[model samples]
Target: MFTDEVVDSVSIQSLWRKSQQSSQESRGCQTRVVHSAEAEAQTVSATISCTQTEPQYQATQQLFPNHDELEPPGLKDFLQRVEDTVIRELVKNAKSHAFDGFQVNWEDHSQLVSCLHCLQHPSAHERGLHVTSVSWSCTGSVIVCAYGRIDDGDWSTEGSCVCTWNLDRRALNPKQADLVIDVPTAVTALCCHPKQPALIAGGLYSGEVVIWDTSRTQDPVLVQTGMSVDSHREPVYQVAWVPMQKKGEFGVLSASSGGRVLIWTVDSDQGRLVLNSAYALVRQQVPHSSSSSFKVSLRIRENTVTNQSTLSEMYFRLKTMLVHVLSLSLSLSGEVQIFDLGRRSLRPAATIEQGDQGQAATCLAFNCQNPHLLAVGKTDGTVGVWQLSTDLTEQSPRESAQLEQIANQVAE
Candidate 1:
């Protein structure tokens, strides 16, 4: 059986065969129409316009078919009679002094605005820090600038620094600062001490208030709030040095966006601030008189200003009426209300509807040197220096009588 299988395998191997192949060549052609890129081009333009205007009042024109027939009577005689009188009056008026020095000036004399200085800090500038606030020292010889972010809303732990320059210094450098105080966080507000030129009060983005004594050589921070329970939980927008009960000593007054205002005194021994008093602004607790037209809500946590003057102005976001605290007068919508702080009434003492109810006032300052000069900072970023009307600021003999009448309002 093995021998027969070997013979059959050799026969099958001999039968393995292959097929042959052939090759041919062919060609075809196609025609195309193409335009030339290097060509001469020409362009033509034509325009036609016509305008014709006829005499106006043609329809109302009364055709004088009989011009001589409708001639005015005694026109020559009337002219002769008034000619002498008109000439005499004209001659007399020309010699009169009523309008001799009068002139109409249609242009304003205050033309160019003066830019004093363009100060900068290289370290803060290189780090892309924005100047949040600026203040002038009491002597007016030095200016301080606080570095922070204004466009960003997110919380940042990025360190901040305050740069100061002595304008009276011979080597005043705009590219560099005379003094730089490194801070722990971004500064939101800065104010130089009204009396002390070396002291500066600042509010930070981290809801802390810091007092920096620039006169100090090593430790610039005199006192600060370090995450204490009595400290502000929200970012402080405003910080001012308010006069304390103790003579010659000042207290720190800070207002936050959370509607809380706290006052603190410097405790240098412990390097901390001691809480003196606190005030919170609440919408429900607001005394709404009947004179108020539209409702208002206390929403501004980003801006606040305080000083030692009797005049004060408050600003709210939505209300057209300026949320002001003045015993003199206030206006909402179109009515000006004169109220008393001592009396508790739902109605105002007197209402004057004919008062200025224009755009709300934001912040203001009174010149202690010049009582008439009042600088008002508006919501539109324009500061208006108003001269108080003599009739308003001037004391009148009838002021007492007017107070008595308001105290006993017989009319409802």
Candidate 2:
């Protein structure tokens, strides 16, 4: 046998060379076995080298830089790199389908208005009034329908029309409304026809529905009233115009305080317009056990002539659904129900119970491009979005399979 010191020195050098060779062959392969005899020889060599001179292990460590110390960076450099990574991630997220947010730029402030407060006419009510419902005329003029208590201890009359500065004119032409329509009771809901210009339909506190012709200055040409012997028992809460088909019959849809949805057909018989109640789409009880007395309070009070709230509500709700009226949505008890016009049935589309449940849904709107994208406003001044995608059915399986394969590969 060789001297112990010489044997140990040779073994250490052999072990280092073998390690380098194995690394060079396959850096990623972690399972290559080392011969036990070779390892023993290398250990013996290391022991002999240590005995013969100042420990070679210490010298080797000094020769090879410590990875952690060599790669240390200053605070500024580290922060800059982090910021760059964050910016890149943000850009990628914005381009991805997962990101949803509003992006718009307005140059002129006057072009928009908030409907937070309903402007007051001094002679109409002693305390003026707050707008209960509002609708936009065909010419882009605002039709503020106000309802509030007058000084006379009686609920003031309903269906008052106040025209603000015409937005189409692009100037502040604000003026007190000279035109007003006194209905049987306070108007609870308002809707404009999709095809007919200057035509408005409203549901009233007296459980009646009325249509107004803005072209005529006098009282609304009551096309059909719902207070008849066979009218909806409960007060009407919401009204919507059916999306006019590109080439088909035109109609209107109305939702009642009693959870009844009705569809009507408008026909012209020898220059005389006849509104016919055609179908009762849905007539289910409100799902929530809360008092049916729940109503959405308009943020606009009389004497506060701002259109911001109204415009924003309209922009998010009405404008979103202008593309396809096939479905109608309302949030009840934090659950969104979509009414299919074709099926005439209610379908629970989505549920958003993450936020305050007590926050009643004030308004709901749909995206123009995507019918499944809905924007909902709550009574607590919060807006939430729900995105529905049919693509999920196709992509989910493939994504799950891909993830499983990645995990399996990592395990092996």
TM-score, each model? 0.48, 0.38
The parts of candidate 2 lying over 4 Å away from their true place are 1-120, 123-128, 139-165, 168-175, 243-249, 267-412
lDDT of 2 by residue, 311-402 (tens): 10111123223222233344545444443222223532223442457544545544333444444544333334455444211234434565
lDDT of 1 by residue, 1-412 (tens): 4454433334444333322222444789888987667768899999999997666655335553445566578997899999999999999998897654333434322221122445667888678676666666777677777777665788889997888878689987777889999987888877788889999999999999999999998999888887887788888878888897789899888888887778888887888888876665776846566543333333332223332233223433222212122243333243334333323444443433321355333333333444443333222222233444342244334455555664465221
Clash totals for all candidate models: 0, 17
| Cα-based lDDT at residue 282, candidate 1 | 74
**Model 1 misses residue 130 by how many Å?**
1.4
- Worst window of 10 by summed lDDT in candidate 1: 317-326
Model 1 misses residue 154 by how many Å?
1.5
Error of 1 at 47 (Å): 50
Query: Candidate 1: which pairs clash?
Result: none
lDDT of 2: 0.46
lDDT of each candidate versus the true structure: 0.62, 0.46
